[model samples]
Every structure is written in C-alpha cells, then in structure tokens.
Target: MAASGAAVLHRAVRANLTARALALVVVVLVLVISYATSLRIYFAQAHEIATTKAEIAQSQASIADLQSQITRWNDPAYVSAQARERLGWLVPGETGYTVVGADGKPLGGGLTLDSTPTDDPGQPQAMWWDRMWGSVKAADKPAVKKADPGKRAPVTPDSKPR
Candidate 1:
C-alpha cells in the first residue's frame, strides 16, 4: 500500500507540471500579440506626426512669402515704380517720349491714343470732345455701295457664316 501511494503521488505531480507549462505558453503568446499590435499603432502615429510637421513647414513658408509681398506693396515708391513700368504713367515735370519703328509699332510698348489720327507737328493736338465728334461724324456717313451676292467670296469648309 505504501508503494501504491507513492505511484499515485508521482502521477499527480506530472499532471500539475503539464498544466502549468501549457498555461505559461498561452500567456506568453497573448503578450507577444498585444506587443506587436501596440508597435504597429506607434509607428503609424509617428508617420502621421512627421507628415503633419512637413505641411506646417510648407504653410509657414507660404505665409512668409505673402507677408513679404504685402510689405513691398505698402511702400509708396514701390507702387509708383509698378505704375510707371506697367501702366506707362508719367509724373509732373517728366517728359514722356515714345519711339516708333518704321512699321509704326511703339518701341517700348508705350501708350498711344488712336483718337488723334491727323497728328500735325505745327497744329495743336485735338481735344477729346473734338476727336469724339469727328468719330461720330464719320459713323453717320453711309456706305458708298453694297456688294452684290454674286460677287461674294466662296466659303471654305473651316469658315462658319455669321
């Protein structure tokens, strides 16, 4: 009976050892899975932070450029320069001269008023009202003659009639 009791005790110890080993393996696996999930989330958040920082830097650079432009526009000298260069403006006591080529095009993109057609060196320039009156008078004149339908040019395939 003493020998039998020893065998039973030995079997009980072996069963307890197997159960503890199995429980330890399951707990280890759960810990490893949780750690892997946490690492993935951490890396994703880190990447987002880096992207946001880059966008913030770009926005700051754009704001700086706009602020510099605003500062330049605030100056009166800058405004006057822009007007003279872009709009061909002339200030008081400044003589405005335009050079024309043989083709009659202005050399420096200078402003020309088409109203004064008969520009004479001896005569004074026409007033705005006089020019307007001249244009009105010209428009009041009727056409000398109308073209016959038979004389009209043949239409091309690419040309659409009005």
Candidate 2:
C-alpha cells in the first residue's frame, strides 16, 4: 500500500507539470500572434501616411501652377498677348492687314507683322496694276459654280447613255 501511494503521488506531479507547460505554450503563442498583428498594422499605417504625403505634395504643386497662371493672367501684357494670339486683336495704332493665298485663305503666321522679309528675289514680278487686276478676277470667280439644272434634258431609262 505504501508503494502504491508513492506511485499515485508521482503521477499527480507529472500531470500538473504537463498542464503548466501547455499553459505557458498557449500564452507564448498568443503573444507572438499579437506582435505580428501589431507589426502589420504599423506598416500599413506607415504606407498610407507616405502615400497621403505624396498626394498632398502633388496637389500643392498643381495649386502653385494654377496660382502662377492666375498671376500671369492678371498682368496686362499677358492678357494682351493672350488676346492677340487667341482673338486676333490688333494693338492700338497698329494697322491690320491680311495676306490671302490663291486658295482664298489667309496666309500663315496669322496677322502679327514680326516676319523679316527674305532678300531672295527669285520669284517673278508682276506690275502692281496687273496683280490687282488678277486678284480682282480671282475673287470674281465663284468657289463652287452650281450646274444649271434647267439646261439639262430629262432622259428615260432606255436612253442607255454612256
């Protein structure tokens, strides 16, 4: 009976040690999982903050560009330049002239007279009166001459016209 009692006491001690070991393992695992979760959250928040800062910088740059454009628009020179380029406006005391090509379209470089005349005189020269008469004749010619429908005769399908 004494030996049996000692065996039972040894088994109880072993069971208690196993339970304590299992509890310790569970606590360690929970600590490891919580630490990993905290690390993930921290990294995510850091990335978000970095992205937000970049967006803010980009927005600030756009705002600066808009402000600069506004300042330029506020200037009289800039406004005049825009009006001259966009609206074909003539400056005060400046004569407005247009050079038209044979196609009845305005010559390129729009109306600004800043072009330097080239010294190349290879082109044929016509008298001023002749050139004026030529332009008058060209302008007199219609761009599209409509066919005189009344001058045409109606034909039947059997006419077999070529």
Top candidate on TM-score is: 2
Worst 10 residues of 2 by lDDT: 110-119
Q: After superposition, how far is residue 107 of candidate 2 from its true place, in Å?
A: 5.0
Per-residue accuracy of model 2 over 1-162 as CA lDDT, tens digit each: 999999999999999999999999999999999999999999999999999999999999999999999999999999998888766898889987778889977886644444654645786567799989999999999699788989776888867675
Give the distance in Å from residue 103's predicted Cα in candidate 2 to where it truly belongs: 3.2
Which pairs clash in model 1?
Answer: none
Measured by lDDT, the strongest candidate is 1
Candidates' C-alpha lDDT? 0.90, 0.88
Could you tell me every candidate's TM-score relative to the true structure? Answer: 0.49, 0.51
| lDDT by residue (tens digit), candidate 1, 1-162 | 999999999999999999999999999999999999999999999999999999999999999999999999999999998888877898999997878789988886545667755778788988899999999999999769887999988899988888
The local lDDT score (0 to 100) that residue 125 gets in candidate 1 is 87
- Candidate 1: stretches off by over 4 Å: 1-22, 98-162
